[model samples]
Target: MAVPAPRTVRTVAAALSAALAATLLATATATATAPARAERQHRRPPHTWTVTEAAHAPGARIALDDTTGALSLAVSRDGRTVIEPSPLGILAQQADLSQGLRFLHRKDRAVDERYRAKSGKRLDRRVRMNETRLSFATAAGARLDLVVRAAADGIAYRYVLPAGYGDVLGETSAFNLPSDAGAWLSTYRVDNEGRFNQYTAATAPTGEYSDQALFATDGGYTLLAESDLTGTYSGARLAHTQGTGTYRVELADSRVHTDGSLTTPWRAMITGDLATVTGSTFTDDLAPASKVADTSWIRPGTALWTWLAGGRTAGQSLGAQEAYVDYAAAHHWPYEAVDSGWYFKKDEWDVTDPDWRTDSWMPQLVDYARAKGVGIIVWIHQRDLDTPEERAEWLPTLERWGVKGVKIDFMNSEAQSMFQWYDTVLAQTAAHHLMVDFHGATLPKGIQRTWPQVMSMEAVGAEEKRTNTAAHLTTLPFTRNVIGSMDFTPGGFQRVGLRPNSDAAEAGLTVAYESGLQMFAGTPESYDQRPLARDFLDQEPAAWDDTRLLAGSPGQEAVLARRSGERWFLGGVYAGAAHTATVPLAVGRGRWLVQTIRDGADGLAQDSQVLHGGDDLRIDVVADGGFAGIACPWHPGVTTCYR
Candidate 1:
């Protein structure tokens, strides 16, 4: 299906204005006596305006204090407040819209639509929200519109500067949590590779935090994140207002200057239980539709990465790459990523050299892999392709070599310029029909939605960090991976000292972590030791038709069920101590032959059983271990199934 064009607020506002004018004549008699009221409207506009989702379960109420001219927002779900009254305002170059504001008009409408995604947790998305646009004039007469969208799962709002208004300076937006609320936050970093530590609202350090801050409250869980980040504005972080339980907005750049008008990214509050937040699509919903008109070429699948196990310089030779390619082909994997040492010395930046690939062996490996029905993904340092001229020269060369994708590494920044650079690179890759995986990068904020060719990004502290505890792995689905695809480089079966998770647990991450380009970070010999686990990875599909967080708790345990075609893959990981639990088979009304891969007394174990919907399947997860299984429809003759 052709991707739908985005709807602009101006067009919607014009239509709404015309409708309001037509109704004005009918209420003339009632409005005639309000002339005195109209005169004082600037000083005392509506005190409060609220918009609720279709279900009326989640809503956002904007309160304006006529006396102080301060605007605040409160959010609620299931009759419980998720966010208290929090400040809301935007600072602009022409005028400060943070204070002394007068409401001019308000227009509201219901939005409901569905679109197809190239790859994600789910392929088809149904986005429904209640939208309201509130226009306000600063004391200096600068016009600004606050557009709020209330979805059944969350609330999102963004600042829109009209054509006449100047550029933006900053914002005073904040998420005020309850005093007793506990948060799981990552320290702010340019590479966004910080551990998510737990802290009380009052005791949490007063410093910069990453894109998302997960708060656990009496009401439910709320993931604070931003979406639809474009080149017009800078990336954002949260700074704790020391001991006050409020986290204020912090922009990466001081000022933002754009063309005619500018629209800030949406500040989203995804409120629900762990399941709701894990399965929410608020991030993708807020981004623009796919820019790649022909998404048929985009394929999501697993790749065999040699760098993690081979120590960065492995697989540089054609013979060495051919072995990895052979492994991928034998296992039905789609691609093999030759990382870090293909065209340059260690820690070198030779990508832009005129004779960069003069003595290259990559073309031979690429052709050989193509013959074996496998694709090659080469890694390039960010510094080499930082310029448009460099990218223009290299991107087409990669295509000519039959390279399916590029794993660009070491970006380590999220300023406004870097964000624009990301967009430009994605567009260039799309033009050449090349896929991209961003490493050493910022956390994803709906970039996959805009550029479907962007398969995944390395925003979490994954395998390369060498410190992934079960707690960190479990925390990911609710935090990092919740907002977008995460490339955690799972499937580390080798007994490396750095890897602490059990073999079964390591295998489970391949399913637990949702990355379009799921890179298995293990040597071929290591993976061959456990056929059950290796077979599971080979059969699993990276993209899914449906996903459900069957059970989860941050830093503890997470169990997910993903469906592709007619098969359902279930995976779970547990932290700290060993535990056992009964996972219900909620794949809907059908008898299924479930194949289980789990931790056993000696090592990995496999079992098969026939079960009906609602039946309980008990799993014995070892300490810091996990389990996984695939469920398929029961057939009369076939006793087992593998996809």
Candidate 2:
């Protein structure tokens, strides 16, 4: 949808004056002699919201207070109620409240305009205030209450969804401003079409504003944030998550004075909370009926095969199959992926033909991989299915074929229609009991909590593309990875050629940085040649029961530690330059085994080595450089096992 033009300061002032006059006139008519008394009695009422239905209610209220804004909302079976900080002065001043009104002009652009129209008409002008309220309901008689309040500097919103909705659908809160106001603006859309659902839609007038969108999923809740139009793709944006029993989106009014692509400022956080809410929380709340053999399906530790290497004939290559099986068997890795070309054409292959059954070598290869204890994950493109019926038709067949999961790729990111598609795909995929990995998509929020089968996703470009740099990889762990698992296909066979000082060390560090399902991106030949790195890949976890953001900040240094069984894996990355940080050893107790990789002091080479154990180790590393260490209890039973 198109963004409306921003009104001029003069126009905004005039509108405010008009609105205030109307409010004053109404107030005078209601109470001519008691104006002062009424004004004095306008204090906030006590929180009276209560849960009326027992089974449907989550029975919670969320309150937030920040320098820029404050918000309060309640959740119950009946519905949600919200009260935001209203700009009382503006309402009392503006003359024509709708004078500066703007909306998306109907046009055929991204999708057919006819199919993309708003489901509801423009809300009554009376309800249009600086403070806003939104309510959502589920078929189970549960409801959500959203209250938005404006602060001196910005705005904030809070809400709680009923417990039995299974998962949140999608949410978007847009502002309709004046059409003629001359201002620079832009648009952004983020969606994880392949994994746990993450999608966003935003618009600005000139398409020149900077934007940043973030999604975080913790526990059983999701948080999303969107910053206002800025000039560059960098800035601080407020975010709220379900772990905190709230979702907040904030926009800052700023000017564009630099040269760069217009990026949106949006943040999303997802988590689950049975008690009080907290930010950056992760929870798992998979439906009881939908839970699979968690041990059998959710294996901890790496995969040897990816679709990129096999190229056009990936699906039908016996050599690739043998290579993958060999790598898995030799390394003790549990999984392998049959990327995009498996079911359909490699470049322009179609799924309709029977190449796999007759002409190609897939039948033998699939059987071979199974024999070697390697589970296969196939690749499916979002565009492959035109509608929900087609998805329904194919998913069941995949499940029957014993396909462990599907990697869906190349989804339209920024449209409302596609948002619905994202939600539908997750719902349908769950029905078939198949795992999912999203590629070429937006960042993940917290879908994993509600649907644990969504293993990982690829939003940021990883080692597979060849263009990604050590700096880019470093930025992800702190920024994107903070939200959840990223399918940054690591472990490329090709050595680092761009920076001589950095070799395979960056790749190794990246693998450790990503605590999600690990996909090794290099060819089987490359891995076989390097036994040491190959050994590390073999022991990597497929999924983590818990993830701890030990230390770091967005676009800076990041240290993440994840546990599976009795092992604790830690990875730290720094972007562009060198830095020092002290990280705590909290994964377990007693003695442990530690392996590390850090930049060499000579400044021209990265030192690759291992260390057995140290209670607390001091680490000093250079830019575009970091370290990876795995701490396993020196003796069994000394540390708590994640398994």
Candidate 3:
């Protein structure tokens, strides 16, 4: 015989059928008992049911109150409390689903899923978790389901509403933190390009707007973010009260009307050690599966972009674009981005030039690029291709001209309509066999999983603006880049206005930052000036088979080692004073050839050495400096590990 689940209520139909029979039997038995004993039963408290596996793990755990219909969650690591009991529920237009409700039924199961990523931090992923679905009915007789998943890394939960629920006003989900926890958070921006500042839990900012918030508890670290967003719901932000260690969810729109069934995105709490914080795939794992049937045409690689070097002046002509294409072909980079000013006017959104004489340059350049084994990614303002009609008008023409990708710019919003537009554009791009890179866009939320052709998105304060500091750069790996691909446009040697990083850090960003379409941000002449740095850029890979956080932390230093094949690449960035960083070579057990580039007195320095696995490679770095290296399997008398 099978064992019954503990703390589970009977289904509504079964309970209703048994109620009259049980009441009659109880009436007959009460005649033989004392009336005082029966009256005392009304004073008992509501039942609190726990959700955990057969052998309870020491990670995140969940619970629900049967009578009150309130849900709360907590997290622990190595027997220390990381997250306290936090409130979670929904507020529907029909009824207040948070209180005055009754339990209906409960279901629990195990989930073990495996899939291959087209482009991301890791190529192969396994998402294993224990799931619980708890059903409840509100006072107004409205039904809702609270779904929770407990993974090895952390926990995630979301709301599922049936049809006829007119509107969802908001969510009552909040992250309650400890009093001593330290936090790193970014103020809300439409483009999600804000600096992350550190604060204590009590002193954290109080506002209606915020991006992802990271916290360091006594036990470990935790990051609060959301994923699997669609057009039905607007993106959310954190609502905080001053001096309180609690933050609640506030939607961008005041209310979202839903006529059909709806499933909100997963509210994820990724918690663990420093390595877990940096290496966790919890966010993307919560996304929906891929919608594209054929993904062979989607290739992830580096691109040469000229906008950072000289703005529109450098990429405005056919000769300048050809130079970029030549440089890309020389370095084995797969793509070259042709930015704005390719059309009739620099600022207008016109790509349909019927006049062949004025538009003849595009096809000529496309043919030249195709002959050189390079793909051209043309830039278009987001307004030009946001709708189905607009995309149907130009996408096929660009396809006919043999353009492989499109760089859509200036989205700058996370409203529900923009979310729908993102889906429409990505689906259309995939149908036409083209890749996409979003600029001036909101932070990535695992849309890449559903649409593998979304190569990258520029949601960070990239090099094109030149306002990012070393500390800001160091903070991204643990925060923004943790969720999905961030196109920061690394590898610029020369500095312009307000840029304060060294040449060594520029090289380091190329490896530390992970993006499917990594843009090399320098003119061809600049790379010619520093050939060794160019050599390192040529050796780096855009996507990884595996990744590890070897050393350092957020806002101090970040040392990462990522693997592509049998070889491993290491990148490190440091802030504040100059120092030597000790990085352990955890590649594997064998003799390996190592080529390194670091900070010198004048510019970037380079060296080559041979060492065994588990040996430390220490490099001296200057203030706000960085270092990068490649390690390959080595035998006796080997001159080069990579061509």
Best by lDDT: 1
All candidates: CA RMSD (Å): 11.3, 17.5, 7.7
TM-score against truth, every candidate: 0.90, 0.58, 0.90
Residue ranges of candidate 1 with Cα displaced over 4 Å: 1-46, 163-167, 345-358
Per-residue CA lDDT of model 1 for 1-643, tens digit only, reads: 2333335666788899998997887588557868777668656654799988855457798988887777899988777878988999988767777878888899999888888887788999999888999998867778878999998788999988866556677899988888778788888988899988888776898798896889988769999988889788889999985587898998988876767888889999988877788999888998888899999888999999988667455557677788889989999999999988787643223556666575477888898999999998889999989898899878999999989999999988778988888878888999999999999997778888889998999988888776667788889989999888999998878855787788888888888889899999988888888888888888988999988887788998888889999898998888888878678888888799988898898879998999897799888888988888898999787677785
Q: Give the TM-score of candidate 2.
A: 0.58
Candidate 3's displacement at residue 517, Å, is 0.2
Over the stretch 447-526, how does candidate 3's per-residue lDDT look in tens digits? 88888898888888777665677888888888888888888888777663456577777788888889999988887888
The Cα local distance difference test for each model comes to 0.85, 0.45, 0.80
lDDT of 2 at 401: 64
Ranking by TM-score: 1, 3, 2
Q: For residues 1-643, what per-residue lDDT tens digits would candidate 2 score against the true structure? A: 2334344666888999999999999888778758666665554342232221133322333332222122233322223212111211000011211112111111111111111100001001111113333343323333444543322111233333333333222223222112221111112324322111122212222221212232222212222333221222222223332222222332222321223212223222221221111113221110112233342454334666456455445434557667767777777777777765565444333445765334444555667877888777777788865497888767886776666777888874533345446667877777776778887664454445445566776765555554555545544543455445667676665545633224334444544455345777777767666554555555566555444555554344556666656677677766556556577665655666566545455422323222334345556666566666566666544332222
As for lDDT, the candidate ahead, 1 or 2, is 1
Better of 1 and 2 by TM-score: 1
